[model samples]
Target chain A: MNAITARLSSFRRHLDPAVITAFACILLLLFLGSLYSRNFLSPEYLLQQLKVASFLGIIATGMMLVILLGQIDLSLPWVVTVGAMMSSAAAGFGHTGAMLAIPFGIFCGVLIGLVNGFGVAYLRIPSMIITLATNAVAQGLMVVYTGGFSPQDSASPTMRYLATGFIIPSIPNSVLCWIIVGAAAVFLMNRTGFGRSIYGIGNRERAAYLSGINTRRIVLTVFGISGGLAAFGGVLLAGYASKAAQSMGDAYLLPAIAAVVLGGTSILGGRGSYLGTVAGVLLITLLQSILSVMQMPEFGRQIIYGLVIIMMLLLYGRESLSR
Target chain B: MKQWRFWFVEHRGTLMALVIFVVMFLIYASNHPAGFGANMVQTASNKGVLLAFVAMAQSLVVITSGIDLSVGMVFTLTNCLASWLVVGSPAQVILGIIAVLAVGAVCGAINGCVVIYGRLQPIVATIATGAIYYGIALALRPFPGGTVNETIADALTGKLFNFIPASLVAMIAIVFVVWVPFSRSVAGRAAYAVGSSETAAYMSGVPIKRAKFFAYTLSGLLAGTGGLFLTFFTYTGEAAYASGNAYTLFSIASVVLGGVSLMGGKGSAIGAIFGALAFRTIGDLLFVFDFDPLWQPLFQGVVLLLAVSLSAFGLLRVRNRLDWFT
Candidate 1:
């Protein structure tokens, strides 16, 4: 009996309790959703949810990287909008524009991210404020570009195929994109020097700099990469919806932050995993779906969402945040 | 001369914000078709005061080395509540105003409790609370239609006897009534101490938790005032998600431009007020310049980026690279 108890303790030691809790919540949410509707447990619906989650999953991936570096990108909403709007806008030029739409949108996002990094790293400004300013700028630029009207250009065929098509007979293309991105993120965070540097900088930038890490450059690059991923998410969103719309990204900002935090990524930075973020993404998507299925009013859903996040934070995240 | 220099250094941020606003306002006035008449000033003040109150609310929390994302939501929530209650007879309207402010205080207290007692980060805690506040706001006025007492609205939003904006007067009075007293109080000093260094402050037996709680509570009251004024401005209530978010962001910008360091323990609400006025002027400048209103956001962004970047110049003076993090 003692041997079994010791083995259990060892197993618990290897796992993050927050991640486990998040996964458990996801299951609990699934169960709750099934109680609301029998079809909730069905394969097609679950796959559909996964496809939908991939959008947030992608954006949250970028957010996680920034958060790991102990910086935030409040400019995310507009970055996503810029990506979708610019990519779709590019479709107006011709076949080449359509072909380059995806890359173009992602490029626009990366530009914004690089700017965020520059402001945070080189300028030594707080990440929150810099990202906020950039977000306003992006919003302004988009407003001017679209003339306050919704852009007329629709997603290209390739964009559509990438977003909603079945690339592997049964699996979604977007899910596959998420898998590819997630795999890369896992490898980057767990297996790369860059990842270690991010953690190091997040832990203590002064120490990282003293140790010869080019902290500013790493910051800029992480922000840039985060932007690219967010824009890529936008491209997928524009494709799924068939057109880019103004303020489409507005709905995403809090959710992405909440998902990352919920997944046990420290809001203070330096300690989180890609797998935890993945779990967080699914949990948020599921919670979102369940609330909607329960026919809860939008405001009610928001209240519940906020309350739950706070409750969870109180439960587990209270201690790690102080440092 | 040394004494004078110290005085200048102390007020540098506030004076800079004042100068920026003055210069921008002058430019805006000179180019205006109306040429800066009482009516125009009244209009500008009415618009500017809303942000000023919110900025002041933000500055309080920031001075305590914390951020409150819910001020805008509190502003919205109060606006919605005011629409419902700040109507009918004078007695009823007064009661309604009190209730609105009280609710705002409650919201802020909740934020304080979460951050201080619950041991959560201010940013995340406020964001969550902000969501909840916004949800309540949306629930309060699901539709964008409600009524505020027209008499009170007109009186507050309009100019006093043709020259001074009443909204401006109210703001000043509150600054004197609320800010002066708070800044001189032990709690306020504790807030500064905590912001500068929580550990040191605690070791010195400063009232760290109480100071933060005070800052958060007062912040809510200020935001509530902004919301109450919003109802006065529009004479209607709307649960606008974007506008709420925008106000929150703009308040932060105003705080920064006012020279209140996000790093905490510096700057003043007076500077933040001037910063807000200047920020508002940025939007108005485009109008006088004949630029499309569409250009406002882009123009605002460029100006803010430049302004924030100017503060980064100090980094060049650092001899040790490690000092940048601290």
Candidate 2:
């Protein structure tokens, strides 16, 4: 009993205020919506919301890894877009081409992620600046290639299976995919040597290096994983939307970051949990849904979202200060 | 000859920018004969002036080892205000300008207070503020359509003398009046001290919070000026105009390319100005080549990456050379 209590206290220390507030906000919004709106309790609406959240959840999973290393991938949106474009463009070539495109998409993501990781980890350049540049490059490339139009064909059967198809009648295949991915992520983050090494590096790179960890390699690997995951999310997105547009990934960027931050992950790096990030994703999706249901204007929604993030951050910042 | 060599050694980045500019100009001239004259020059110069101001604003915050992601959003807000208020009489136009600057200053002051008093990191705090500012702009003008006085626009777009553009003149005047003092004054030196080592600066009696507040306020003022210029150039102010979504990256790129250290405490105002000019010139060259507009963002990103890499390389070389001399 004492051991369990100690463990709980340790967990509490790691809990970010933003994550807690976000969770509460999600619950409050859902309760309010269910009370006010007639269709809020429907299985179809709930399932649809889950389906949307899955895409963000998958991306945020990889984003969690990157953030754990104290680095960010600003190029995520474009990479996701490029992946969708590649997937759709390859669809016309049949099954083999589609299969080939999956790796190709992942490869593209890895390339950009490697560039970002190398610049930040090795060259000691700021990650934000490098990722920002790469984002521009990636978006530009997508526009040049696609001309801002949706691509020609639907996603392949396998991709669609990952997106829209389901294990059960009511549950979305995407949500199932999210569950599998989330379980694997939780295990990897909690039980693996790599996970511990990531935390060590994130907390203090010099100290980690001194302790004989290959910090640089770990950083590169984490970014590569982030890239691959983002690309995978792109595949799911193509399946859901049934078309790959040029700016399809733009909307996901903020939510992915927000999910990671709101999941109790420190923006300054180190100390976070995948489970918390999962909760964070659900919370954000619910908040968006509630706002949309409330028929709020775009500007008002933005204002509320900004205020929530700021207030949460302020609370977290003050807590850390007090500590 | 020794003195000249020393000057070259000290200002290698500036010299490199000049060489690149010449090479790009030649490429554009050779490719598009019609674009080689005053028209191209004026447009490039005007873009450079606008970007230079933004770069300067970014540089001020960067010197304190912080960043202002809200610069572009603030620019949009001021632009909108200017458009809405300047449409009346000239007195209204002047008052409008004051109001816009005041609004900008207040926004920046809020950022400063949050960072200093509220103890928020500059990056996170500015990002949130950026969203708020963008939201306010959207609220003010949900869609695209606002008007500025044609006379004011003409004055901005027109030339001062026969050869020089009034916008360029305004830029130069701003540099002389604002940039010089901010970069050379006691407060400016204090800013450097704070950025270099905040604890040390505090121990030495420097008002770190005050210096930071000044930096943010000045950044806001410059952003306001940049927004006014943007309105003049574009002749309209929509909510989406000058959105922070893209300029956040561009301003940082310009500063980095200008040889400003991301870690802070080592760069010049002149370097930042030239950096903006070089960046604008590159874009103009691309336009002259008729590269697809869709690829522009990608090109900007690639160039930004290359610029950052090159800056790092330059720093390495400088460090090596210093070690050898020592």
lDDT of each: 0.91, 0.78
Among residues 3 or more apart in sequence or in different chains, the pairs in candidate 2 whose N, CA or C atoms overlap within 3 Å are: A137-B298, A140-B298
Where does model 2 exceed 4 Å of error?
A1-18, A38-44, A318-323, B1-32, B241-243, B290-298, B312-326
How high is the TM-score of chain A in model 1?
0.95
TM-score of each: 0.97, 0.91
Question: DockQ score for model 2, please?
Answer: 0.48
Candidate 2 lDDT for residue B123: 73
Q: Candidate 2 residues A35-114, lDDT tens each?
A: 98868878888889989899999999988998888777887888888778777777769768777766676677788788
Give lDDT tens digits, candidate 2, residues B1-326.
Answer: 99999887757655666676677667766787575666666766787888888888888888888888888888887777777777778988888878888888888888888888878767767877877887888887787778888898888877766567778888888788777897677778888888787778888988787889888888888888888888888878777733556666678877777777666766655677777777777666667678877666667667767877764664466553223111
* DockQ-derived CAPRI band for the predicted complex in model 2: acceptable
| Candidates' chain B TM-scores in the order shown | 0.98, 0.89
DockQ of each: 0.67, 0.48
Chain A TM-score values for every predicted structure, listed in order: 0.95, 0.90
Q: Give candidate 1's error at residue A138 in angstroms.
A: 1.4
Looking at model 1, the pairs that clash are none
